[model samples]
Target: MKLHVCLSALLAVMASGQGVQAATPDAYRDLNHNGRRDVYEDAGQSIDARVDDLVRQMTLEEKVGAMMHGSLPAGDELGHGGAIYDLDQVGVMIGERHLNSFITRLVVAPRRLAEQNNEVQRLAEQTRLGIPVTISTDPRNHFQAVLGASTAGGGFSLWPETLGLAATGDADLVRRFGEVAHREYRAVGIQMALSPQADLASEPRWPRVTATFGSDPADVSRMVQAYVEGFQGGTDGVRPDGVATVVKHWVGYGAEPEGFDGHNIYGRVARLDNASFAEHVAAFDGAFAAGVAGVMPTYPILEGVSLDGAPLEPVAAGFNRQLLTDLLRDQKGFKGLVLSDWAITNNCDAACRAPTADHPQTAKDIGMPWGVEGLTQPERFAKGVTAGIDQFGGVNDGAMLLQAVRDGQVPAARLDEAVRRIMTLKFQLGLFDNPYVDPDVAERVVGDPQSRAQADLAQRRAQVVLEDGGRPLTAEGVKTVWLYNVDPEEARRRGWAVASDPAQADLALVRVNAPFERLHPHHFFGARQNEGRLDFRDGDADYEAVKQARAARRSVVAVNLDRPAILTNIRDKTDVLIATFGASDAAVLDVATGQARGEGRLPFELPSSMAAVEAQDPARPDDSAAPLYPRGYGRGAPRN
Candidate 1:
């Protein structure tokens, strides 16, 4: 036994002499339980000094983890976020994975979300680094029909969706909406809004138009700037009361064929063949001008596209140095960190080419190497980092990143640079100074009564009258009716009679969605695929019902245009036709009852037919000739 022990000691010493290094304690010290009074810990140091000190003290694993903003385990909670989650998983993500941030998905109770966030921050604080975990959320303040925002009216202010906001053409109101959303976000311990989707809504059939400002680049730019101003509270940096806006998809996302989303390769592949690149850049320019902190790079899984001469061959802005490092960071003069869209680097599997496949064929949470389907998972990470991106979304593993560094694919200095940017935001946000939130405060501020009233007013203001031939929907005539989109309770509360049967009413009212191919929710979100074209066709159940109702009685119809639906068949069927981007059921009813007049105008063209849709180029903003409803089409105050 003595001989064996000596041999083991000698081997270890030999290994050390061969340059094998053991894990050493980082530069942090805990003398007097106050931690080392390093420059990074000092509140009075320059931002550069603080970032440098923090980078030097972090272990490679910690530095890698700092670059990940993974998804929160929202499965066990209330909403459709993560597939599964519990306290143990949270522990692994923060303590073991060393993650310091998570994207908030799906909706839980307001207080419940706050409590969970508090618990998460507590766990993060207990880690060796004690970095507070930042929480981010997609847009949630609006009542968008599709899976745009995760939550709807979940104990927060409810406003019109972005389309509705655009229809209003009120930049000031958009900014105000931003302010409200930011306050509520902060109240719930959410520090980031992965929104103000600066992508132009030129693709009429695009599924995500519900979340856009509009198709007009100039107009969209103005709103984008306003949104940032509101969310960031006009501060060039993060503030305790402010929220950071991650202007998304970088650029050129809305140009997808028939308006498919970029959650996968096909949707992301359909780019503008000859569209105005300047217009696309204009949107990001607006956001950057507002001093936004970060940009979520666009998914570029295309056949052929070049930026400044470099190709998008590996497929993704996350891996394209020309687009991320050169164009955005160098030429465009953007100085913010670039974050990859969720799982953009995931390795493709059985459903690699069929992202919309059902059941087992659906894509998994494994790496989705869309453009660079040829690269391994570790190589994908290294590629993204080399492209000048600072972080990966929804990626929890830091081991792969460490491996990449060891392999010399990503230099330690490059890793440090990424870590520095991330740490700068955290410190600037004062998360290190104070990460805890008062649930009581969240309750008081979030969904406050005053905020609700503003939301109501905004909702009322955003309804657009597409066709008002005979003033058929005036308040007097809407008293007794069959209502579809309008909330029955709200209509009744307003002294309007609500009829259960369509035939029992004097007038028939219907609410229909912008059309698209229906796929399982799991396929659309969990796998991030299955969204398809936007042309509304004849003979669908809802369309038939609306047609039969119009034949039966004087009818009023409101089509909540999530996208510019193919309106050839339904446009001429109703006596009064209205197009609302997204409003409350009550807000719709308010317009129908003439309690509040819709001041909104159509933000994009409503195509006459699918042929028109197919005939036009995805790059052209408004080339739908003889549109059923042209851009900026709306009737105001009954043409009086």
Candidate 2:
């Protein structure tokens, strides 16, 4: 299992005079099992020296394997939802292919998750180079569970969605949230976070708005910077204890035409004009300023964007050199790894390109080649590498990339450069020193009492009170409350009597989600995504519940604003209207009962009508001609 670099290779690296220092006696892991301490194994060496040493020892196959960030397959590949990794598959990926990084999709308890990651690291320790695996994950500290967008909080402390964080308008709170999330993630052996999305929520209809800070570029920038600082443990680059963050959907991914997402073939183009596009790019300034370790290119192809008065290439951000190289790296001075969005290099076959009712699209059928569909797999690899992408996400086909390098499609120097960046991060993260986490400590740290208390308080403070026309919810006169879409136990716990029927209660409370359409039921992500309409019409079940509550008594209605819904109709039905990003039934009830502060402002405008929403520009913020409530509007008290 030991694979040591020859003495000649070490001597050659030393002769090159790249980060070479006098070899000193130091405690080391002997990762290469070379019978003596090597430069990379020495903890005393600089991260740059260690990266250079490691990269020099890596073969072409190993280097290519380093560039592919694949998923940790479950025991049953067909049903891998929140399942533990299959050790057999893990061995094939790590031992045979030399892959040392993976995205863990397991949604088990904190202790079990930590134990599983430790097991994977043990297998990696037995490998040739003994490079520990760096496990990464999507946002898993929130309530939303849109398959590819975010995961549900299982044992982690549950916070409001990113939009809810924006609603609080507190950068410090957002930073605290990141700190808590980082502690929980690292407790379970996750070294990287694929989150803190800096994309502006400009397009209200976009399904991923819930994951963003808000629609304002400046606000998003401020929050994004705090998020990075909190997660990375400082205002500088990632520290040894910090989790490396990957701020995502670089540039303008929120400007999808008609609110369609790029995760599906039909929604691959992000319509961005030159002026509006600049605003979208400005949103990521905070992440850049915070020295984030990684950036993920958006999946959509920029439609109307240009560079220096010339039309740019009509391709996705991952395959666009103008965007990645010129704008991000050269102009913005981003010296970090550029990870492509998932499956950008895979071929879009008939099933992926067009799924029918008979063959509904599944996760396996996803492949987002976009404008580069005509390119071969090897050609796609070459194009992405030249475009400045350091790693291909959601794919483990390093053989294809290796072939491209051998065929002269990708330069060996460029491949080496990418390998250096990847290795540098791993060294900086202290993954080489120790990648295993304590399972017992993980159970004690993840979702501890103190963290949950803070999270619950955050949930209460993040609720936006749009209107309070009826008697104040704090009034002691109200006793018997009728609940719809709320747990009766929560009301009972508040010492309030819960009425079985709406008519028998003194007041009624209702909860509903902003209306959405299953527009693309046949597509994988499209089916899971909450797309299309943001209006709440009469016939809808949620709207009916509101109507029934209003008819019974003064109703206090709270709606989950995952998308900026047109509340002109619902506004008239209920006496009180409140907006929430993501909160538990108890948290909402606490806010409603004046037990906690609920002064959060609207992060985005609620359009007055569907006409205003459709007529508005997707890339512009708060541009609705007539909005029911403008951004930053919220009432802290009951209205007269």
Candidate 3:
């Protein structure tokens, strides 16, 4: 036993050093100074050649490690979410795994940013292949903290949500927005963004609708293409330092029955049939045409198909062979990487379990099952890989996966295939050659003035015009009244009159809660009474408060502080409703002052009531009764 343990340790050490000595000095040269390798430079036959050479030098264990993407725990000790950002974690994971590619959940920070870049560089040096790690992030150009914020929470630049961008109908502005995000990402060592959510807002109550471009399929497609072009710079090829866009939720995740959180739940089944699938598939088709670098599968299943037509019920798309191999790769011709959503492998069983404090029962009513415990993490991972998930996002079971392979649950060849796909993406990203960023260039590009100006312009264009008594609220006629839900400091900074009571105001402006429903005793009161009453109404108090104010002959405007869908419930109560989608105190104030016109429209339909939302078809387009106000229905001028 002692001899075997010693031999294993020796083998591990040798494996770690195997690819390091093979790296050529030319790999360090960024000939174009673009923070990436120049394919034309004589580093090797091509970036592909270098990638193949390095991949060949790696051991099977290293290859398997490469497929696992890991994130650090967000404890209070690290400040708010953590000092160890997702990019930093990705860097560490790459070094530990000897993998060139990974994903991150990082929110960009301008200060102490150099340290973040240095950590990634250090990790790249540790790997034998010297492959730079590609860190991915959520949409960060906004001020909302849905996914949580960093240590200096308020420092990040706030941009208008995608809902607003869609209303502009300007592909150029959307493209420029992507470019700005690309610049910010490059500064912080993020190479991929799991964004440009192309899913058409088919359901009005879907919580994530604000993340998308409004309800129009064509508009969604155009905006996605523009975003992809802006992030990658050119459709023909990726820019040297440009961030790769991951057009996501591959299928109609947004159309899940009743506009729920998860793709599948016990009550919420697939409402989309063949025709519905075709309409929603158009946006993904457009993303593929744009040559997007990555695609993420939704956790929901299509009703009919299976891995091998085994009659699998609620087929997990992340691990479903028919969907990933047959549809995505073959039919759609997506040559880029396909990543699973965060812990999607465990979603099937997890969805079955009761909702947690973080997730809440409201998500369950929408088909997001809170908790179920059937499949283990290893089982999910193996299944996902067989189905063609190239990389694991928010993976927690790397060691378990290694154990599963040793136990013969996962085949070595399958693991190799996953590793190859990841490595190929790294090579395609040109990380094998130029993996370092110039601190000077990063500093200059970090939150560039031009990008901020573009964000401000985009924010202004995204504003939707609201009217009172048939008169549009123009800048001259607008008398702003700001209502604070949490604190008035941010709202008061804009010099608007902060109202303590809505009765005294011309416009009853209330900052509604971000649509997060907590399943406390009060929330579960109706759930205990009847299963039908399980759904929790989000922002109920705020909605009723605003409604009361509107009934008192005041022009009311309610701004959604989170995902814009929550605005649907209060649409009828107000003369003008603005789905600001995300919180940007400055941008919100600008819109209120008429300095920035309201250009945003509903990405999702505004459901008439909670019961109506629960009864609506998840897969079908929102063909419900005309919302008290339609998607494009907003006041063209300020109301008196």
Candidate 4:
């Protein structure tokens, strides 16, 4: 794996001579235009030597371009509640930015995604150095069914969300999912996965619980190790067959101040004291053990937090050298890419707000350079670099990077260090040899039938039943079922009779989501996805809907707990109570009818009431209010 280039290839590259020789009309000779074969172009050298050679050859502009990773011109995909939407902002990030990496979204067709990625690679190849672009993406194959957060499988095999995966509690199954995700991603030219968040879900009211593994340190730790192992094929470094992982929020983000989200300024720190830090860092410790390829810092303030007596200024992790360099790299011995969360280096003035028209509660538009608000953009970049961050997400500009170097604010050696890490990934992924993807292979592999079936099995394993209510859930005599929010056609497909009206059915199957009361509930209306929070205010529409359905007939209520929710409003209003972390309708139906029994357990506790949630210590883990259902409480059986 260490060897890359051959002597014959080097001779072929070197024979072109100086001044860029021309060959074969359309094909230009000396693709790198260096006239002589550079050490970087030779795959026969060690990775460190190759990185050093590439760094030496790069000018300031090229080096800056290598550091930036910008947004791609999003193509047609299910945007904002299944609508035909794309990132319509017209910018020259590609032609002008010249960044070697891109953060992309899923396209409606897998082939089109691969084709567009190939086109981006072509764009990058046109540069002087000809570095192949590495496409990075958020989690796209999960079944969370959100708009801004995730896509609708988009023809890729859909597996349970991370919460669902944790629910299953099967480390091997998680590893298998990593294998599937890597295969599908590579087929479409996606080399990086900005996911597998190692953060805990200790705070029940946290909004991003849909993305976290679980609350318990032990359970989350197992999943984190297995997931990285699966994606990296148990290798300590990046591989051609592997899709490198970016384990996120580096420190725990579950215990947000007052249970609010950290993407915005109001809730910036994981308020927990230094004593409770171990549980927060538990899964990350496991990620370190699993040898993850990259780490993403959270957008939260850690004013009073520190490791090994190192003094940390009250600021976001991205700008803290003590936290990043002293703690993560030196103390913990992490050898991976350190990436900042999106829009962190920019300023967050009043006018510089995040996008809130769609997913209101989680929008983060303004810059979040918490402790270094006094510094200029170039100064901020210099600080992050000095803090041990390898790359800056959300923006792909090198003006600040170049200026930092010119001002003597950042050393050239630091730039080389960052570029070396970046170059290693590009070389290790085998992007230097062949970067373009074949659309045909993408079409077949993105959702291979075998992978899809395995995903379905994982889905089945993740469904959890809390209370059966002394009722035989899947009685043979129960034929007609009324569905509220549950798809009628899907129920009929599952061999059950579907009735539109509750009064006209044998049993009413009401599928309602967990209650969420956002802090600001305005400017969010039509064509938008649901927001996250645990408060179910009295007379809420969703709660009222379930109550009405239950009154109409003897109903079975299943709550989709994207995050740990407060179910006091509708807990006693139904016959059977089921908690689904993130599973398919078919999986839910199978579990309901006893066709497939759930083997999963609750990963977090459901709060008894909003009052209980509000009274708990926001600075501590597993210190929530009285629980309606505690963690690891799956009654009767744990069957797949």
Candidate 5:
């Protein structure tokens, strides 16, 4: 073990090019320009001692800055396009604000990302304390590219969404995926992952179902545990080379009352009864058992819920002490850092609270203060700190937190406590020794052939064949194919000629997504979110295409089930129905042509009709009356 640690340290030093000799175990960085080594800078000292020493030495301004995890702004005003980092903006955050943690929003290649992250760390090295920046990011190794939920796969190995992983019902596969994602993320210099969302997919119409592990608490628990274990290197806490995983949205975030997300004002509260809410809490047991490094509080205010027979404080989870302190920290014993969801403390202005068609909301207008919208910014910060949040995500205003501390709104001890946790993680991650990563290694390691092969296999296995119609799907009989929403080149690669018209083909290959409606276009995230109506209706483009293909020939349909769709209307229209969650064209083709067998089950039940969807409770799972398909139903059989 000792030799392994030494070798790892040596590799990190060599990769970083920091010139620190691995033979000298007591080596330290002279961050303060002092002749003597500070306790925090000495690599030989214990982590607790280093954290305490660092906390004691930090100024109030620096401590406040440490609690704010802001975004690494883009180079130009159009922040969404380029991967280039705005060094000037980063300098202001690091040099003036004293921040050492940031979430990178740049969507670039692995080498460019690593180089930019190294530049950020270089700026941090010049600081008075030289605390290394711990960079974090949302889930970027999947197909979903929602603005805040997930990012595009880009150069990373693409896998099916978490729901698809749940469909496979293989905890080992989920763990393997985490291991791959960890390697890819660390290759790009990301130290923290804001993912492995433990929230259950209880609500059929919820927009974020693709990111969850499904509605069954037991399945979610198993998947979550495996996910954390894989990402953090083991079942034990974060290892030195491991990327820290923040299992998120603490409790009951999936029970959206009317299929509206908590990001907008229309979905401020998640309606949950006591019994149903317990199931939501139980879903996170896997993450807690794995000793996840961090937890992100949910944005929605959990309504009709309580703890120990007392009603929960009517506030968002970030500001609710009963949930964060009394339950999460006390009863559950989760000793990790608690990061508040983005903009929880930001004010809800006119554009935020209510945007018109003429004045549509954007990123700047996002805020989810919920029950405490009346409080001042400093007061909100104090409330969040008191509620047990160690860091505020998507926030750069350290001044507000500093004011809260100076004015005694937030106690100084709490500030130090938060700092200790943050610093301890940085030390545990070996960031102080060497925060840089080799860009060349990043380019080679990320999206390697082996990882891609594993991910592609997973994508194929995760396809849930809901309706096989007693006919095995095989490529032996198929000659000419008509493709809808499938690439013609993929058909040609499979030794099948592509036919322009479905009537002239031997088989019709059609793919569609589970139905959704954009109900709130005026709100920022709401506009992009897949909200409302999980049923296929007439005139719908995807449904029309499916009907057209079925009318011509035996149509084998593949629907991307981002949400549990009401498939009663289209179930009889096709010969075979397969459900996918972020699968590739090749993967779907492989399953459709019997190149690979879909060894997956339904993560969430398919409601028979929209009536059943509306009549069922949003807080419960698989309770719709006369469901089209029950949870765990698949073509071949269910796996453990």
Candidate 6:
């Protein structure tokens, strides 16, 4: 139980430069002589020995480091291509700090693919345990990158966004999509995927709903199961080739008022009543039943109860004992690893300073007791560990966590449990057995043509069919027009007429990106107040396009590429309000042509106005606000 004892053993063996051979019980064994530890084989004795050996070799600090999950910001300097932690920093963490797991924001773009691949390999080499750093990412196979966001990453295969995949309601398709995703991820050395946001799209306006499967619990459940099964393949409770799926925001995260992200609530009350909670729980429950490898908690408070009934007031589910231990572990029987959302440890004041552009300042302003002002770095880290968060994600304060453990604020025994869970997952992933990707096979496997085909199929399947004036919209007869907020190049490639002047087109398609300011408001206080209001009347670029179309005597077809609820503002001006959810040019075109039916219903109710959203109760049981369209409201029309 003393974490340092295990680390001393590991350091003694590894420091001697003697590679472990002939795996014993609890250790990974190459049963097939393939040099990869195949967990599927009956190598239990070896597996147990490896597990024991690993535990014995880990130091308290190393064990704690194993439990700490961090982020790799994909900035140009970091070598991946975005902004956050870079590759060199990642190398330092693994080489010096001995950290392993990381959740990455490096969307699989073509430019940085080589660099990222090299970095993963390098990180593996740096670790004395031969533990390959597991790379995790958000959903990327579709067109739903942040609207107006830079399309810098290499466009990988385009699958149906979560909603589109859900519309198919075909578990097999979902599974196949997951399988394809696994192939792509493994090709790129990605070990884990923070995907298939199992949160039901219960509220339409929620900014992240586009990433969800759908509104109905049943549909969401099936899709969740299929996603897990596909991502973590094998009927034998182990996926040999796929990345592990992390089911997220356990219980009622999707039910936030108007489906907003990260809003707090008092007591263990859910925005939806018990009935709705049951439905939501069913979806997450199904994912657990399907045997996902990880679970993540949202930043919201459930009812008045912090996860563990901790007296600290509104403890984040990430550090809530009741939520993680009582519900997720005990009741739901989730035995996998538990990960904290990014910077949950920074909830304390030392690391929780006023938000910069990188961090949301509004989190501090929200008067939530758990804000950076009240929580210290050590406090946040201790709270998270005690609350049963096995891994720290997007960790900006790894040094603080290390220091806290050294000071004994966090128990060494607890740290080992976390490390054990993490190593177990790595073992389950067969990482020890197959730490290296075949460089020759990398190109073939990374972006396979078949996977691309699957993506294309998903894109087509995900298309939403919209009708204007009782007639299905078709490209043949209609003067296909592209309006508001699309990359001009994308519009042109799709064969749609990109109109600078709204008056010239018969149908005006307006695309709206979710205002990032809305998600992270403090950074743009004055600018946000003036422009961040979700009102369609606000002079948003997309809003202006719709108004222009209305003035031109043209029938407007509005396609909201972000959240579906943005359609409420221009519902009156639009001849057809098509919520493609996310931007997939192919899917958008297909939806326009009626080749794909709009099966996606509003996941959350669209508030009538900004006031309705502001005044809405976060703890309210009902979300019956007047939506442009209700949940499950879809029009079926014959394909043109």
Top TM-score prediction, candidate number: 5
Candidate 6 worst ten-residue window by lDDT = 11-20
Question: Residue-wise lDDT of candidate 4 within 1-640, one digit each (tens)?
Answer: 1112342233123211011111222222233666555666655567787778777877877777778867665432211322222323312454455578777764567777777666676665566677778788888888665443455656888888899888888889899998888888887778888878888887776777888888888888889888888887664655666778888887857778665666555566667677667677777876788878899887787655667776467778888887788779988898778888877787766433333545342333346777777888998998889888888887757788778889998888888888888888887776665566667777888888998899898888887887777866674666788777777888777577887677777777777777765554422221232344575665777676677677434677778888777777666777777888777788887887677887778888877877777788764655665688888878634545
**Candidate 5's residue-wise lDDT over 1-640, tens digit each?**
1222344345344553211122356545666656567888778889998888888889888899999998888854323666688898889999999999888878888889888888998888788888999999889889988888777845999999999999999999999998888888878788899988999888899998899999899999999999999888889888877889999888899999767899999999999999999999999999999989999999998889878989999999999999999999999998889998999998888998889999988777878899999899999999999999999998876988888888999878888888888998998888887777888878887899999999999999999887877888877667889989999998888788988888888889899998888898889988899999988888999988988887555678999999998888777998888999889899998887788989889998999988888999999988799998999889855555
TM-score, per-candidate, Cα-based:
0.89, 0.95, 0.78, 0.88, 0.96, 0.78
Score candidate 5 by lDDT: 0.86
Tens-place lDDT digits, model 2, residues 385-484: 9999999898755888888999999989999989888888888777776666767678888898999999998898899988887455563567889999
Candidate 3 structure quality by residue, lDDT tens digits, 1-640 = 1112232233212211001112344334432234544343334566666555556666766776777664533332111345454554455566565554544443335444435645665556555545556666677776543431111232344577777777676788888887777776665556777787888777655556667786667778888888898888677545655777778887767665645455334423445766677677787766777888888877666664333335434655676676778878888888777887765644333324444556544422322222222566566666677777888776633675676677687887777667766776666655544444444555566666776777777776676553444554433533445464535675456455656666655555555644444222222222221122222264467655666566333454646623334345455567655555554556665665555676655554554455665666656666655443456555542333
Model 1 worst lDDT window (10 residues): 15-24
- For candidate 1, write residues 1-640 as lDDT tens digits: 1112232233212211011122122322121134345676555677788778777778888889989888776663222554334668778988888898788774666667667777787677577656778788888887753343345656789888888888888889988888888877877678888887888777776667778887888888888888998898784645545788899877677777766666644455756542365677776777878898889887755434566665555466778787788888898887766888877767656554444435433424334466777777788889999988899987877777778888899987788878888888877665654555656667777778888998898888888887776654566644577876556776678776877777777777788877666453433343333245555557676787677677435777788777787667776887777787767777777776677888888888887877778888676677777788787777862342
Local accuracy by lDDT, each model: 0.71, 0.84, 0.58, 0.71, 0.86, 0.59
- Which one is best on lDDT? 5
Candidate 2's C-alpha runs over 4 A off are 1-26, 75-79, 637-640
| Ranking 2 against 5 by lDDT, winner | 5
Evaluate model 5: give its TM-score. Answer: 0.96
Against the true structure, what is every candidate's RMSD?
A: 9.5, 5.4, 8.4, 6.0, 3.2, 7.4
User: Candidate 2, residue 422: CA error in Å?
Assistant: 0.7
Candidate 1: where is the Cα deviation over 4 Å? 1-36, 76-85, 145-149, 235-237, 273-275, 302-305, 309-314, 355-359, 362-367, 470-473, 500-504, 519-536, 551-553, 637-640
lDDT winner between candidates 1 and 6: 1
Worst 10 residues of 3 by lDDT: 12-21
Candidates 3 and 6: which is better by lDDT?
Answer: 6
What TM-score does model 6 achieve against the real structure?
Answer: 0.78
Off by over 4 Å in 4: 1-31, 34-36, 75-96, 145-149, 352-365, 521-538, 551-554, 636-640
